[model samples]
Target: MANKRTPAASENDRLYGRALAVIRMRQGIPQQRAAERLGVTTQAWQNYEAGLRKSIFTVDGLSRLATALDVDPGLIEQVKGLLKEGVSEAWMSDGAQPLPTSGSEGKVVFFSRRAEPEVPPAEELAPVYGAVFAGKPGAIAFTPDRPDDWKPVHPNQRGYRDPFYLQVHGDSLSPRFEPGELAPAVRGVWPTRGQVCIIETHDGAMLLKYYERRDAQSVWVRELQPEPREFGVHLADIRAVHAVVGGAVS
Candidate 1:
């Protein structure tokens, strides 16, 4: 007969199982698909989700599971509440140290320190504004009303002169700049044809669109998805145009 796990080990397994199940549901990954990606039987995956089996994941196994869910392994540890404050290393090693578990008065550290590569610090941080609609032209009010919201950008980000972040809104640029995504905008950078840009109108209305071209009299812009349509705005009605350097899903 197989030896039974200790009570503490079983409790840890249950916690990990519950955390994994929650993450899978939140990520919208079907159990069958996740099992296939993890190279495990569907029933085995179900057992983990159901807390019927103890979780004893190796480093590779944990990484593979994280990849299948499209999330960082640290996120999994966080969800399970296994990560303790000031505990930088999340994995257990031969020389692992004990950290206090939640609800436990004494320290119960489970992770060990490992010689890992150092990560460089982030470049500069840019203010993240509320959603900016691409379909409607709105005011280009540049102010630090809410300085708390911001995102860090790498120093080498292309066209990153005086860059700021804006959350995208509307489906005018769907798939390219989905609603709720964050986009980096660089001021003082002139955009070329086929490049995405944020345009400010004379009336203070701002909009995001693809820069088709611009003549002495007017500027031509278009939407890329949901339906392609072009607009011609007279040069006299324009104020300033900022090019979109990059974007990421929020």
Candidate 2:
């Protein structure tokens, strides 16, 4: 027997089709032209736009579609709202079962169908630390003193947790970053390759650069400025590492 489509999946298909139609119309591109740009047959594209067919665009396909439509690929995810709405409606219509909040084993299981609890506003401010360099060591040490001189940033504004800010100085990371910019770093979050991060050396020095890779003995980094420069430091010399959430020009 064939499986049936769930309400959430059906809603997703409908929303995707509608959004695709709207984007195509807004771009003033005819169905045939849009289909050709997407490298699909006219009938297949029409069926997709009419919600008769499901969308199966891969990562590269989505990028191509976004390029042809002149829109960001992330915009396609907006259809998720339709799935959420469908789930809510299904829970209401199908009489959702509520499991016990606490089980005999002293455990708790929360159902997704239930309304989400209210989240309090994040009002706490994160402190900005002293400047971290992108070059060789300076005479100054990495100090957390003088909280009065630091900038206080709201964590909710950037979706960060236990965030601390740092000032950027030197030209090694120029073009992408400039001196006097406030870089927000989230504690305890490990950064992947190509992400900007704050690196603290055991000798009490701090640096900010793009994280390249790390091995058992050393951490490699890159600086994109006048040109790309790569370097590595022994793990023994490193104190701590934090991912740079974002930054603002001061």
Candidate 3:
């Protein structure tokens, strides 16, 4: 289903976009830099500035943007007022005002954190390297890629380094991650406690497990389904550990 936008909704989008653009430009914050700091894609940041999306109309979005741009909290209030109450005094004090909306103005969109995100187009799909065992010990060998091995990339993994997908093997992480689902992982990132990770060992063994902790000697990991258990893999035996951002059914 498509997201339908009313005339008022469209106007609100533009109004919020222009006001954010003004503050962002005044602060000399580059869109890419702001997006990187906010942990969003550059295109997502541009959408916020152009008012194409209402993802930034909430308190958390604004707070994060403020931190990214180093803008004062008062400016956030001014922007909110311009959108909600129309023609804020802060804008008037500067002898300029944001474009006025129609009398039948639509309320601003303040999406909850649980709001669904826009889907990525087919062109943005990542490749699935091979399978990683989520239950038993498995080899780290990657099979040859077929013509249809592509999978969707998560929004948060957009700027991650060397992103690739791996088909999950076994049901150890079931009810959350399952067999045959594609797991997106990135290189050069150390997995922290509570995160699922794709771990490669020195002996060509691959594991898909919850990261627990690590010390100079070994890294601890866990599994949930069938039974809950934790174990440690020696750091010297691990070749690489990449965080699994999320899983997608293939």
Candidate 4:
């Protein structure tokens, strides 16, 4: 059984709670959803965040949390050290830690410090945003929080100024793009004819379409799934267009 968190440990709990809050926020996961993922009640999750729950310090709790947050379980030790020793360089390397793999159902493979590698440069990493729709008009608001996951920058994406990745959520661009595929996209690079593009409109909406053609009045695009169709967004209303490079490699 896990030990109860005592009032004397309140400071440590508060500090740990803050770390949990940061990870949860970056993934854009709601408290309710996190609770569901961890097999706990929403109020339990809230208590965990308030430093009132010590159950999370147990082995099972840590495993569930690593899976729930979609981060490495090794991170728990880093966080534990933070609580016991105060601040250090843990946060600096937190973003690039590789995700944990499942050893079996409900079990996460933990890595030892001896097996870890030096932290790579931030530029070599690409932030993987949560699901983005491919067929419909939606909005993707960039948050100050870190992304849900990170991947090594793709070879083809190396030349771009700021390259990132997002998981496809819809199939409007089907065959060419299947749902759940992670695609690399880069800013400043304009999409050419027939290329897949991520477009942001002035109204703050985003769209994924094939670049068809553009004129002074409108920028046209094509969609494949459901039915083949073409549409145009007013040139003045278009905010930015990013090219989704070749699919994520390795």
TM-score per candidate, chains pooled: 0.47, 0.48, 0.50, 0.47
* lDDT of each residue in 94-167, candidate 1, tens digit only: 11222223334543333122333233256557777555677665633444366437777623232233657777
What's the lDDT for all of these models?
A: 0.61, 0.59, 0.65, 0.64
Give lDDT tens digits, candidate 2, residues 76-107: 44323423333232232221222112234534
Superposed Cα deviation of residue 173, candidate 4 (Å): 0.6
Winner by TM-score: 3
Candidate 3, number of clashes: 0
- Candidate 3 Cα outliers beyond 4 Å, as residue runs: 1-116, 143-148
Query: At residue 36, what lDDT does model 2 achieve?
Result: 87
Give candidate 4's TM-score.
0.47
Give the per-residue lDDT digits (tens) of candidate 4, residues 6-55. Answer: 56447767766666765666445689998998789999888887777886
Flag the better candidate by TM-score, 2 or 4: 2
Ranking by lDDT: 3, 4, 1, 2
Overall local distance difference test of candidate 3: 0.65
Candidate 2, run of 10 with poorest lDDT: 92-101
